[model samples]
Structures are given as C-alpha cells and as structure tokens.
Target chain A: AQSVTQPDARVTVSEGASLQLRCKYSYSGTPYLFWYVQYPRQGLQLLLKYYSGDPVVQGVNGFEAEFSKSNSSFHLRKASVHWSDSAVYFCVLSAQGTGSKLSFGKGAKLTVSP
Target chain B: GPKVLQIPSHQIIDMGQMVTLNCDPVSNHLYFYWYKQILGQQMEFLVNFYNGKVMEKSKLFKDQFSVERPDGSYFTLKIQPTALEDSAVYFCASSPWDWGDTQYFGPGTRLLVL
Candidate 1:
C-alpha cells in the first residue's frame, strides 16, 4: 500500500526564518505529491504539487517543494516565513490509476513566532 | 477560485442515530471525496464518488457508510447507526476531471457521537 509520512508533528520558527517541511512517501511507482495548508477554521489551500518534469515546483504564497525520486521525498520550503504562514501542512500522495483518492500524512503544524 | 462547502459545521448525535453530512462541491468538479480525521490524528480517506457511482473507497469506509448525489444536489455522506468511533471531522473535496488533479476541500463537518 502507498503511504505518506511527515515526521515532524510540530515545528516552531521565528518570522523571517527559513522553513522546510519534510515529507517522505512510499510507493512502488511514480507518485503524485502535493502540499496543502489549512488555516484555522478554513478549508485546505493548495500550496504546491508535483506530477512530472521539474523536481522543484513553485506554489502560491512564495512556497515551493522539491521532489526527489531517489529519496522518495518532496519537501516544502520557503526562504522566509511570515506570521500568517502559521498553519497545518499536509503532504498527500496519489498513485497512478487510483481515481483521485489521496493518502495524507499526519500533518505538520507550523508556528511562526515573532 | 473554486470552493467546496459543507453544511452543519458541527453536529452532536447519539449512538445508533443516522447522520447525514452534506457537501457542496465545486460546480464544475466531476469527482467528490470524503475524508475522516480524528482529533489529533491524520486525516484518512473514506470514499470517492464520480459520475453518480463510487470510484474508490478505503478500508476506513465502513459498511455503515454510504454516499449519494441525487439530482445533482449536494453530495451527501450518510452514516447509519453511527458508532462511537465515528466521532470525527469529515472533509469533502472535489476535482475537476482527472483523478490525479488538484482537489478543493471543504471546511469540514465535525461530528460528535455520544
């Protein structure tokens, strides 16, 4: 069975600091990866996704993710963070021919400190 | 921007009761999904419905669970004889066409079973 793992349950960083959220996936074939952010009392917002081609994919809010096939990892990164960036981040995986069903990680709660 | 709406943001019910969770997916979307998230736990995929039929369902989708989109109305997830274990947050999502495409998620409906 394909699965996604986000090792960190929570991460705290000061505003303007660099941020990285690690995500590792287990699948036998090429996997579709995505990063989604959920604000308090709000639905999830897509941050970025990786299907093919470029290993580094840029997304909204200055967020980007790097997909490494050898590592089976797609880590999200931002050069600088803002307080508004504090939210729960989920890493999702979809295998080929799954018909839109996504496997989500436990999620990493990021808190931007002042 | 597309959005998905879920009615009854919160619901409190007793065990063995029937609960219906309503979801209004993006108007142009063709695929709908349901996910369950227990407090402090990872969100788990429940089922996906497309073109008025179930496309795929996960192991978490219990026999008590059913989904329907009647007359192109709100997509609904019904839990018959709801169990205590069913107390969780349910999120509804939809995608435009392909299963590997991005999905828009709802704010989620929190169900409390006592």
Candidate 2:
C-alpha cells in the first residue's frame, strides 16, 4: 500500500524566515505528489502538485515543491514565510490503478512567530 | 476556482444513531470523495464515488458507512450506528474528469459521537 510520512509533527519558524517541510512516500510505482495547506476554520487548499516533468513545481502564495523520484520524496519549500503562512501542511500521494484516491500524511503544524 | 460546500458544519449524535453529512461538489465535477480526519491527526481517504457508484473505498470505510448522490443532488455520506471512533471531521472533495488532477475540498463537517 502507498503511504506518506511527514516526520515533523510541528515546526515553528520566525516570521520572514525560510521554511522547508520534508515528506517521504513509500510506493512501488510512479507517484503523483501534492501539497495542501489548511488554515484555521477553513477547507484545505492546494498549494501545488507534481505529476511529471520538471522536478520543481510552483504553487500558490510563494509555495513550491520538488519531486525526486530517486529519493521518493517531494518536499515543500518557501524562501520566506509570513504569519499568514501559519497552518497545517499536508503531503499527499496518489498512484495509478487506485481509482485516483489520494493518501495523506499525518500533517505538519506550522507556526510562524512574528 | 471551484468550491465544494459541506452542510452542518458540526454534528453531535449519540452512539448507535445515524448521521448524514451532505456535500455539494463543484459543478461539472465527476468524481466525489470523502475523507476523515481525527482531531490533531492526518486526513485519511474513506471513499470515492463516480457516476452514481462507488469507485473505491479504503479499509477505514466500515460496513456502517455508505455514500450516494441521488438525482444529481448533494453527495451524502451516511453512517449508521455511529461509534465514538467515528467522531471526527469529514471532508468532501471533487474533481473534474481528469482523475489525476487536483481535488477541491470542502470545509468539513465535525461529527462528535457520545
């Protein structure tokens, strides 16, 4: 079965500092990766996605993720984060032949202190 | 951007009772999905429905859980004889025909079973 691991349960960063959230997946075949962010009292929003093509994929609000097939990892990165960026980040994985269902990681709670 | 809307932001019910959560998926979306998220935990896939039938379901989708969308109405997930373990937030998502594309998520319905 395909699964995701976020590793970090919580990460605190000072405002205007860079951030990198690590994600690792266990899948036999090629995997489609996604990064989603959820704000307080709101629905989850797509930050970015990586299926094929260039390793680096850009997303909304200055968010981006790089897909590494060799490492089986797709980590999200932001050069600088603001207080508004504080939220829960989730790494998701999807593969062929599973009805396009997505498996999500345990999620990382990001807190940006001002 | 498309939006998915879930009704009854929060629901409280006793164990052994039935509860129905409604989700209004994005217009023209063909795939509908349900995900469950326990408090402070990651969101997990429960089921995915398309063309009035279930395409896939995870092991977490117990026999007590069922999903349907009648007459092009809201996609509904009914949990009969709910348990304390079923107390969690249920989120609905939808995507266009492109199975590998992004799925828009709803705000989620918080269910508490006592």
Give the top-scoring candidate (TM-score): 1
User: Using Cα atoms with residue i matched to residue i, what is each candidate's TM-score against the true structure?
Assistant: 0.98, 0.97
Give residue B100's error in model 1 in angstroms.
1.4
- The list of candidate 1 runs beyond 4 A from truth reads none
Per-residue lDDT tens digits of candidate 2, residues B1-111? 788999999999999999999999998999999999999887899999989999989899999999999999999999998999999999999999645789999999999
Error of 1 at A30 (Å): 0.5
Cα error, residue A92 of model 2, in Å, equals 0.3
Best candidate (score: lDDT): 1
A1-114: candidate 2 lDDT, tens digit per residue = 999999998999999999999999999998888999999888999999988899999999999999988999999999999999999999999887776789999999999999
Instruction: State in Å the error of residue A10, model 2.
Output: 0.7
In candidate 1, position B108 carries an lDDT of 98
